[model samples]
Target: GAPPPPPARAGGWAGAGSPLLSPGEVRSKPMTVLQWEKLSMGKLAHTLWGDGGSDGGAKGAAGALEKLMEPGRAFEIDISALEGRFARPDPSARFRRAESDNSDRSTVGSADGGTPRARISLLEPKRSTSVGIVENKLRGALGGKPLRDAILEVDEALLTQDTLKMALSAVPTTAEQALLLAFQGEPSTLDRPEQLLRSLCGIPRLEGRILAMMFKAQLEPDMDELLQQVDSLKAACEAVQGSAELQALMQIVLHIGNALNAGTARGNAAGFRPSALLKLAEHKAADKKTTLLHYTVEVVQTNAPKVRRVTALLPTLAQASRVSLEELRAKSADLARGMDQVERELTALEEAAEKEEERREALHREAMEAWSAAKEQRDEARRRHREGRAAARASEGGGGGGGGGG
Candidate 1:
């Protein structure tokens, strides 16, 4: 017997049926000693010896066999078990609920905290300055009072251009304004930016005041530019109108043009339009290379050199050419509209301030009248008490005298 085939192991081989040959196949094949040794030297040897080839003795064989014969475990992963262990509910569920509640509240135009929501803000907290800083600056600018009162007291002269620009940037968009208006959340619960915006929203005519201030800040530069353009145009017109040299140059061109057309129907020309000066370049001389303008220049240089100084007007003409009449008109119209808007806003602000003053005065008067009435009533009660006391004393004296006489 070839070592009496090793007793059947609990797991058969390597935790399953033999990897090399099945039990039935081994019985049918009846492998020779050489074939078994060769097979054992490979996978079977490693499996039996636990990766260290057998130590070639009964003791080592017995130990490896004992190790292999032990009960084997198959690792099976149950996906459902994994899911139960690791799955988690959505973390944002509460946030979603709060948002829905806020939406409902907004629609109803009421503030009710059915669910706790994340704080909302117009600007990022980490990237922007704290809302407190912004609020403080605004408070300082608006006279450190309630927004409603501060807006009325805002002084255009006190606001710098940079401040106006910042205010313009912070001006809420229509949708943002609507959102702010709809917000019914507790002010303490809101982020600083939101709270500031909400306070601004409570003021009357806030947008108009900001826009008017911005326009006023820009008005000086706009007026200066407009005046500069006008001055440039005026200088150009004056140069053309008053320059004797330019006038003489034109006269020379006119005389030369008439002499060239002599004997033709175009001869004896007394005058030509100012536009005809441009045609001087179009009329070529007999050589074709020399233009009428070239000829006129040569004649002026040779005969009347003093009139050539008209070239000084070239720069003025160039500057005037760059000035677009239509653009100037458009700018002027825009400035006018801006000024009117500013005036209206200022007038409205003044009237609101006056009305606020009148209301304060009226309240003071009413308070004074009430105080006077209360004082008069108290004085009358004191006078009646004194009179009653005096009459009582007189009756007492009269009674005592009568009793004595009796």
Candidate 2:
């Protein structure tokens, strides 16, 4: 409850310290309405009830408040003058209630004791100071009604921090997970924002952090899967790279290609890209039954039977050959970039949790796991990459020496 207003002045409200102004008179006021809003509640109370003490000493304000609420005394202010000269409009339209009875009315008396109406504005309601405008932008991407209901359930206490954490945790960590969640609802209920989020599509700046966290959570599994594919491809490429069996097998195919293109510019070419291996089966003989590659296979079986099993080395060659070596290297580089970003995000999350011991500890554990997994996968990839490079170097040297000889 508010401390009561000060008592009416004894000399019929004539002095500068008077609560209400006499008619046809004006006096300088201390604060504009906007400035009044900026004042603390304690300072505002002092502004309204304190004596003419410039130093803001506690004695004058306390004494004035004590005197104001003394029994049977009425303190008043000129509302019309305040409204016309001093009041500034508040955008938030918040105000404090002054009367104990929950009524908006206050009594003003004339010489004949007739009542007159007056209006007084008070303080604004407290706002959530911790929330920033940037974080609020996420609401648009979070699905409006559901997010609003969630916020209502959580209330405004520590709302900004708590909502951020909830968003990070609730978002799907992978495209597959997100898809499952999205379809869990009825087909008719599908919406654009939900669809986008479920598909791991990027959101706007306000909601971007949550999406980033989701991507970070997915990095470990994604890296593992990528490394597995890379290992398979690298193993296949290495097996085909330096094998004398593969060289003999290719020598048969090269002779066929050259004979078919004899006396043409294509026949003069020394070598072709390894990716052209797939085209071998497409070129049929004049009989339209046996392919050039089939004849090469027959030649390998007839002349170099021990090297016939060279074809067995590349079990995944069809799938692996669809991607170039450059593409493989690029994918590995992209994983490295993603790991770097995740590390930076983990560091930031840790710093933000400085005041929260439990969260900080949990983040520390997660960071350790993420770093260790990334390091192990990276080291394995480096070892495979070295093997792939050595095989490629050996293949190039062997192929160059026997150029056109077949």
Candidate 3:
């Protein structure tokens, strides 16, 4: 059976004999205390051994289910499977044995198979399950490129040539196109980085291309050229996805830009003021496109007054002639609700004007009464003085003649 265990090497008395005399037949080796529990059968097979197995093979399967049953004993895992490193492959009992045997042979191969040259070929990095394998292969493709060159290559290949032209020119050959339509078809792709890939790849609708460019400009810095391209692209987007919803968003953006930009040289914010544009900010487009339209409508509803105020201020800011619309509208919406409170206060002041007039009349009446009392006292005092002079003259019988004789 299996060549009688290779005829018991040298002095070792082996003949596929089952070790006995132990309490329980001892079966193969005792279970390893490795984190066999963490790795899946496939991981055990791939990372631990080589051969083939989606799920780990027999040993891994036995070990996975048995690790918990095992109480104590150190079991070594694949170096890759060590804490913080490897991803566990899927598990399968059938493949575990084949992979384990492969690992054993690898050890044997290195130890005694042949020359160092043979071992090197056997242990080529590409042939192993190491991430370095692919990393090196990619480097090999670049022919020893520097990091900066690599980035430049990506900008050209991934951005300009690959997407702005190739991918943008036609539908995708992969399922990506279907997925794109499904996502862009609905609104599921906005937040996902992968979904944004369609725009980056230039696989979306015509208008989506401009939005994508805007988003790219937003994400990338100092790319003034690309940002400029966003303007022309905006026109294309408008023409392609020309629905009411998208139009409304467009109107809102222009007004907001104008309000904020008021007098800036950019002149970006003067185009759309709220009053001149709300009716223009249509969300009732006949074509059902889930885009900036739905997003704008939701934003306006959530912060209705802010949207209205931004639209209304558009015209006034435009009058500034050379201000940044961004500057004018910069803080216009921070207190959207406060504008309401200001109107309320003005109304209260108007109503209080009548009550205030009544209080003034009452104060004037009190002052007039005090003045009349003072005048009456002065007149009475004068009358008493005159009478006193007359009485004195009668008693003395010579009031005016006495003074002349003296």
Candidate 4:
């Protein structure tokens, strides 16, 4: 036959005698016997002569040729396969594997493929710490389910602030995540800890779930504490307002202030600002020793001794003073926001779980339908075979009777 046309190139098939026809390209395209021989010779020359330049290239070419031409080797060369055999390994892939190995080895019991105790040990190096204790408690609270499943199925009561915190801390690191993802395609290769880690990583928005749980755990206690603080502050304000001793003391201070300003424009003032109490010590007596505060104390001791009981309110007032109303408001707002966030995360988790359940059901339904269809097809085939056999037997019997009659 006439020489077959060359295979189409990327742009289009090269024209006859095109100088751009590479050795590999020429080999890949259709060619006559003479053309194949000529190209094969060219390939041999190129492999032997080292791209027609460089001593290093010559040495590499010779090394490659020697390997290819060794005893028992086929004379024919597959350039594509040979290139593949010599291709450099991906650096990033190598790095990831190294990192994964390091992470596995770093865990306490990963080498032995991990036991329950070993898995627990992997949570923290120092098991005596509070965090470790919480992690242990969390593990128990999870009821032996994988962390991912526990996030979905665990009772709300089982999730405490410390346990949630521990769970958050125990979330897999990047290297572990990578390892787990790699093992997803080959789950049987995973060790116990790896299996658990893989499952934990598999949960949708796992970090968000743990965070929501943490926020939920803190919500009640924080709200209760905030309410208690507000109540205490209200009670303190009420006590200050209702205290006869405090009222009496304020009255005395007012009278003393009016008397001191007797002849001035401020004389007989209706009442002094409460902030004036801070300056009582600045007002000295004639001897430059006794302050107005001291004189007020003496007067209270002699005339209104019952008013001395106001001293008891000092500690409560001091504490109330330290409690910034603005800060409390901010805290309350933050708690509210946190609660909202928790609700959103929980809603998302529920939806995700529902969707997963639906997907599973759909797959199961599909499998059943497929199985039913197959079974029906099998039954039909059997029925047809039986009917065919019966028809053949009847036909043979009729023919035999006819032959007998004849």
Ranking by TM-score: 4, 1, 2, 3
lDDT agreement of model 4 with the native: 0.55
Looking at candidate 4, the ten consecutive residues that score lowest on lDDT are: 30-39
lDDT of 2: 0.45
**Candidate 2, clashing residue pairs?**
6-68
Q: Which is the better candidate, 1 or 2, if ranked by TM-score? A: 1
lDDT of 4 by residue, 114-224 (tens): 333343323343322433454456668777645566677755666667657777776777776775576535765644445556667767677777887777777778888
Mind giving the per-residue lDDT tens digits that candidate 2 earns over 138-184? Answer: 55445453443443243333334535565544343455344545465
Model 3 lDDT tens row, 223-288: 453344444455443332322222233333332222222223323221222243343233222222
Segments in model 2 whose C-alpha atoms lie over 4 Å from true places: 1-205, 316-406
* Candidate 1 Cα lDDT to native: 0.55
Give all candidates' CA lDDT scores. Answer: 0.55, 0.45, 0.34, 0.55
User: Which regions of candidate 4 are displaced past 4 Å?
Assistant: 1-152, 155-159, 172-199, 254-292, 301-306, 309-327, 357-361, 364-372, 375-379, 402-406
TM-score each candidate: 0.46, 0.35, 0.19, 0.50
